[model samples]
Target: MTTTLPHFEPFSPDALAHRGGALAEGPVALGSAGYTILNFELATTVLRDSRFQNAALKLMEDFGITDGPVHEFRAHSLLMAEGRRHLRLRTPLARFMGPATVENIRGILREIIQDLAAALDPSAPVDFHGGIDQRLPARVYCYLAGAPVEDAAKVARLSERTLSLLNRDPSLTPVIVAAYDELFAYLRDLVARKRAQGLGEDMLSFLIAQHDAGKLSEEELFNEAAAMLEASSVNTTHQTGLVVWTLLRDREVWQRLVEDPALIPAAMVEVLRLYPRPGVVSRIATEDVELNGTVIPAGSDVHVAVWSANRDPARFENPAEFVLERERNQPLTFSTGSHNCLGQGLAKVEMEEVVRYLVEHFPNTVVVEEGTDIGQAGGRWLVKSLTVDLKP
Candidate 1:
């Protein structure tokens, strides 16, 4: 018997709200983008299963980026690697993103946050997204890559334009192609400069060292650096903005964090659950797989609706409401299993520090609703603008 999955358009305008309603229909759905996993349990299962591979390469192919530097990069990048190859590429980068390393960067995060925040006027509502969130992650990336601090803006722009491919808009192919070319050129020059200055302790220098030690081929070395740089900032930028937008509007929760800063981590997790930046994690089914009594054929595109899974009633109590005290509050915002986000720990610590800074410095800050614009598209939540009255 063939089980007919319900039709779902994950990229719909009201996708965030619609995903919750779709869960009631079933765990799996047929959509234009492909099959969507709607429940937390199944989403986790699919994310952990190696049968489904990252669809990024396929997605690029679909967008007419079949043969080019962009195509070659996607084909060889860590995102497409598997098993031993994946671990090999991931290990060197993992050291810098691990819990201890991320924790040690807290003081540095604080200083960066303070520096970004210092530029804002306390007496007026400011565009928090642009002035702070948009810039912090790139600066952090610059530090990690041992690049000049002055290059932060270009790094942010390249990261944004390159990763904008996730928007799934074919029209942006030209822009995307151009961005990757520029990114490759920028990274190549940066690597050359690092070599001239001699190796250092920064992440890029470490990758260079790995290449010199023969652990990573010269090509693999550039690929690893390019992959890391491309993914470093954009998502973190929006996610940080979302955290502030959600917490500021929820005055009661805002007060709790303000009163007890220890709760910021939990609060951050809750915000991630409610408004995950990467709402959809797309995968390609390499072979026929039966999921929840439905057979997904080979070469099928499987999108794990992270936002929906995080709010699945079967998994989370009071799926709609934000509850800070929920036990086992892990969200798929950073994904799961082997291919999970490498920078999650660092990103979380960055957000927590930002929250902590706000709580200590501007506990009375409130969202200026009129100037704030938050929206969802292509199953991703984005912050267009976030205005906050720091002293209000």
Candidate 2:
């Protein structure tokens, strides 16, 4: 049986969220190359089912991308692993990324965000995306990753180049490959520098200690560091910008947040539900299985339209509207099941603090000129360069 998948503008995240659910109404719809599951309930079932495993590692290998920072970052990261391999590394890393650890750093994060927010020029429009969003996450995570905070700008630049590789765009492969080489060298140097000093309390130090204890290999430690750099910085950066964009775009939303600070948390949840930076989470079927009356064959890739599922009317009331006090507002922004994002705790801490500070400090903040980078595939839903007037 053949299924005709409707054409979706792959570049626009908003369009995908608004149109994907309708286009993929059935249990599962065929995407450009694989099956696309847009139903919220079915996507949850697929996420938890062991038959559907993460395929990012296999996809990268299939692309003939051998070794480098990209390989270290994506091919061996927890997001790409399954079963025992995933557990082996994730167990230790999870401890470091838990709520307690995240809470411990809130004070530091607040200081960083507050300082950045203070630097925003009220007299003229400031490039909020580049000036604050891009820098804050990198600075915070670099400190956590045990890399010198001074090198955050460099790490961010390198990560941006290598991030294109994840989009799986053939035209950008060469540039992405070159970026991997540069990033690999930088990570290697950074790792070496960290090693020269004794283990500290930072995340990278903890991973290095694990390596020394024979739990992870030297290569694994470096790869972990590289992966942490990308995840901690890129995703959080875009999300922070998008959340602010959502708030300021709607005067009522922004005013509400300002008037009632308690609503900030719910506002954050709604923003994430409304606009997940990583629009889709995909998996591959390890064996043929029947789900919601649809037969998914073995070896078939399943693209879970996270953006669509979050806004599915079945799960969310008035899916298009952003309800600050939304009940049971569970969005798959951090994914679901065993492969759920490990850095989600950190992201929440970073976001809540940043948003709170922005709203409180810049009460009259308004978008001046805004644009998005929608060309890339994964983790590319950025407001890109948002010029905002931070005046009162």
Candidate 3:
């Protein structure tokens, strides 16, 4: 079905860029056809408020986007859930994903980074996403989910295909669908095996035990596994690119890291603050609410533009500059509040480890061509397609 709503002003990235990156001061209206969109909040507020929904399904319907391999998988992740249902599932996730717990996992994650970076051939042009960056979180996610490290590359391929739903052609749905089924089935069987072994220490094993103990349903286990795999794989890879991009363009950031290797982790935080991969997490307003003096009526779609919010002058000094030492940059990168990413802690650990290795090993790495800006079809800025020459 087409959009069922009122008319409002149009908002597009092209238009905004053409106007020197400034848009109207309030929530810019986006019409699906001729609809008033809804009483919306800035993307950042929408991300934090419980009233809003991801409305991904609603968006697909309005845009006449039919089922495809990638879109189908996206429908299963926690990133798309709203309200009580989201909370119900996310609570346990928070248990293992807390900051302190993640901090403890750094030793193992560091080992992975050291091993992987040691394997890179700096003389050759490597596809950073598929080769280096993807490996950063692929092993971590596999270990967390109780999957075999031997299968990380295979799983990464499935993830790449699934995430392609964001910008891939609708015609590729069949291929991705087939890959997803195989991937999901393999995970389900892995969970079963872990259960048969009488419990596991990893997250997937824990999920399996929960399923058997009635804490989680069968459907929940499968979907959640897919969700975990994809979220862990794609977002991390994209953020790795963000770090590289930031470092390549700014010699000072690189010099700062080289001078103080201990600061790589903090530099990574700055990267997250500047260029987060996952698109703005949005919510559908369930009720009318006032944000910064604007009353958004119920059922509005709110989005907290991660990039914009992170750069808001009110929040950070010199918002546009990349400050690895910024002590007050409370980036909305991992978001805040109840639904904040359950895997953020683990993701950060992986990032820190990878960044450390990259700094220590490739101190003078430079992007030869500076690569192309692989712009996202779905407004994800971090999913850039760029190739560069790496050298000392």
Candidate 4:
């Protein structure tokens, strides 16, 4: 009763402080009508599972999942699907697309870095973060999935717009919906081409064969790839931006890495912990649950507040500090249990190699202010651009 949203966007540090450990505003009324947010006692019980009946994809309608033909097009991807449907696609997806594969292909990941490096104009102002954030994942998506490189810029643009609405404006659902559709259509073409010519080294080819192997279906193939790119690639892009920012500001962190290259892998996870790309977790409850005299009712929406929980004073001492050497310091940047991000390992590999290459080549990465402000808009904090003076 004491707080109001839009005034306080949940999962932010401010809201967590005011609401007393990230509790939802309660099963209170949304004014006038009988619209009420669900009463949630425990946040994880709902999202820590896909078993709850409330995990239904249709449940998106009651909450903030946007609606539109274009939006609906994206609804079938793995991010939106749960239960048996999710298992069907994700099972095979986990097989070939696992973390080991990403790490093993460090050579390709390095090549991707070299491509970004070549695009740099150290003298000319450029938002290194924005360019790489957009370029890396988009290129990764198209390349790994066997899509067209020509489409990377457009896919990157639409991907950024779609995810921007995730944390804030529910009203902008329409625009987000259109972006989803545009991205899907683009992926669909790539899937078809890969199926036709049989590009055997990449994921798309693997997927095409997997379907023929009874691991995936025609629908599963489409949904999985679209889901793969949209769900997996986007976060890597955001993390690329954030980790770069963290490195530039913390000169000591980079200097340490310069002294020891093997430490880059550990440093990557530290950056992931320090500044999570999503920066928040949102979930909706499926059943009544009781904890600490609070009852989170069935169907109530909840934001899991991983940002706060991972930084919980009880769980981690000095939760805000970036400590690369902290033992047992696994950040919840990727949620836990079943719904944990499937692409997390790939993200780590990509970020580690890129930062390693840059630090080795430049010795120092400093921010350039002019290139970073051009496209700053919305609830987006990932990177508009990052201009850093670097020695080549």
Candidate 5:
């Protein structure tokens, strides 16, 4: 309800605090790239509007996932699908990652978090990103995907490689291709094993059943499973680091949550708002549409600056600051519309549990540095590292 000037960098957090509110006034055209809608209201409309299609293929081409095993692997991604095909692929996977699934595996995930927390040495500085944040989500998703938990380290490495291919660098194309092959092969074999051994209650098994029912082809099943790993592993892993950084940076906020654990859920939402993993969510305008007095031609690529929108004054009071109990707080972190993140519920459970465990265990945590993997193509900003000193 409070208005503030946009003083932060054009797309940076600081810019969001000061200039974000202005977005509600209108949208801006970014040269040939397309229109960028920063206003909360406009962005919401753009995302939910069926006219703006998911430019998955455009993004893939832009990121160089054009051909090879990686392309084949991504061909059936729920992220890339449209119409009934998107629903067909998304439905079973969504059911697997739905709220019930998260709740069912909550206890198992708690054990994973507790184990990671227990391993942290209070007397030393820990690479919280690698030691816990990264490990926790990867392991949790691995468990959910019915993959081998013991192979988490390997899967994490492969997930990184698979995501990095999105960079679209020519030199790294071969490396990216190899990584995709290795990952696809790994999941393919695992799917085969699950089939031979009989599917279980896990997500991978659910997809396998869908395959058996002739609802999905075997290749689609494998691609979706791989996509699940790539999708779930990367965003959750990096976002966890960002969430931890947000908490540790504001010592008072950290202390408050530690003192009252009930605040964790709300606090997590706020953290996600300020540091949504994917800074920008894009779509292609299916028709020439007039928005906020601007005419967007048909087939024009459009982007929503999520980071800026989350801080729009029109949406939240004191959008820059991390307020745990902000009323009517609905950050576009998980995005909106049909293509919104399906695994958000699971992400919430994972983040809430991991964050609470960290603050509770490492009460005296201090952030030494925040690391982001450079040159990642537009989606989630990868927090490659976060060094934090822990206390007894």
Candidate 6:
């Protein structure tokens, strides 16, 4: 027998913080949307368990994308894959996004940051979110996909529109559907052009090579490319902005980071823990599963409240404060287990490089609070506008 789970609305402002203060209430809660795992321990268990599959397909269906190319892609994409097939789909992409490849790309990241920074006027406050964070990830994606640099803006637009399904706005179904159609067409053209122009060492070229080698079918190849493109930008853009916004506002941390550039990575991780972009990782319980004292029925939706878990006192000491030197400071920002974010290494390195550039070039950068707007929606933190004064 199980008692009733308390009602909780995760998207409510300061909900995670409020829930953090009420941990003794239990680790799980029921909401209008679904069941939420509010503690670190249970959240990790649910994330790693194969019984809880990704809710992306369900999310699409809920938006009226029950059949067609977008539906088919989501149903068979890597996010919905399991076991060996998941590994098979993940391995090729992982080689390029893992630590070693990302490290080699660090120099390129620095160059890109420098170039973007060069466009800003140091004497005035600049729109950091618009000018830098929003633009960098798509440029990096272009480099990875072997797409033309001129296509960065278009790539950014496509990514933003396609992944906007996460916003949970039912009215945007048409936009999301059209975006996928455009994306599929763009990828088909890009792939055909790559084959015509001869293959290279870039990721898209490598995927094309794999297809030729009979490792991936035509549809699987397109699905993989679409997955990579859709995921490559929007979240990373907001996260990079969040990192910059958090670090610049904390003068003490900013000074320390400027003094010792070596602390950049740890400091970035601390920021990630506090302000994760993906606040909730939604999943569907494939079978009746008991978590804690509650037996979740089969096909129930489970929302892993990452923001709440990251701040749960049982997991992090001084759960609300920023502690840069905290040992084993691992947050579920990129998640865990086999299905964890494949591009996390690349995302982190991109942010670190951006921070590294600021610390090295403009040590006195500060957030222009009046011009900045940071807020949360659907339980996810997003940078609406971030202005910074780089007193170079």
Most lDDT-accurate candidate: 1
Show model 6 residue runs off by greater than 4 Å: 17-22
Candidate 3 lDDT score at position 324:
75
| Model 6, span 1-392: residue lDDT tens | 57688888776666755645235568989988888888899999999999999999999999999999999999999999999999998998888677888889999999888988889998899999999999999999999999999999989999999988988888999999999999999999999999999999899998999899999988889999999999989999999999999999899999999999999999999999999999989999999999988999999999988988888788899988888898889999999988899999999999999999999989999999899999887789999999999984
lDDT values for all models: 0.92, 0.77, 0.64, 0.63, 0.75, 0.91
Residue-level lDDT tens digits of model 5 in 219-242: 888878888777767778888887
lDDT of 3 by residue, 134-195 (tens): 77678877777777899888777777776665542567655656766777777767877776
**Model 2: lDDT of residue 21:** 52
Supply the TM-score for candidate 3: 0.82
Worst ten in a row by lDDT for model 1? 17-26
lDDT of 1 by residue, 1-392 (tens): 34978888788887777635245567899978789998899999999999999999998999999997899999999999999999999998998778888988899999999999989999888989999999999999998889999999999999999999988889999999999999999999999999998998899999999999999999899999999999989999999999999999899999999999999999999999989999999999999999988999999999999999998888888889989899899989999999999999999999999999999999999999999999877789999999999987
TM-score against native, each model: 0.98, 0.91, 0.82, 0.82, 0.89, 0.98
9 Cα displacement, candidate 2 (Å)? 7.9
Instruction: Identify the candidate with maximal TM-score.
Output: 1
lDDT of 5: 0.75
lDDT by residue for model 2 over 1-392, one digit each (tens)? 44445444433434463543545447577645577777688888889888898877666766777675566567666777788988897888899888899899999998888777777777877888888889998898778878887888977776677665557666777787777677778777877887887778888889988999999988778777777765667777788888888888889989998888788888998999988887777789999988666678899888777888888888888999988789999998888888888889888878888778877778888877434342335523666566677883
lDDT assessment of candidate 1: 0.92
Q: Cα deviation in Å at residue 78, candidate 1?
A: 0.5
- Supply candidate 6's per-residue lDDT for 2: 74
TM-score of 1: 0.98
Q: Please provide, for model 4 over 1-392, each residue's C-alpha lDDT reduced to its tens digit, 9 standing for 90 to 100.
A: 13342223443324333322233543222222112222222334444665333222443353366565444545666666677877877777777768668778799878888887888877655667666766887787777776678877886777666665554555776676667678678777777777677667788788888888987767778777666666645667767877877776787878888999888878887776655665445554556654334554666554554444555544556667778787777766776656778877777887888788788788866766556542222222355566777752
Clashing pairs in 1: none
Model 2 lDDT on a 0 to 1 scale: 0.77
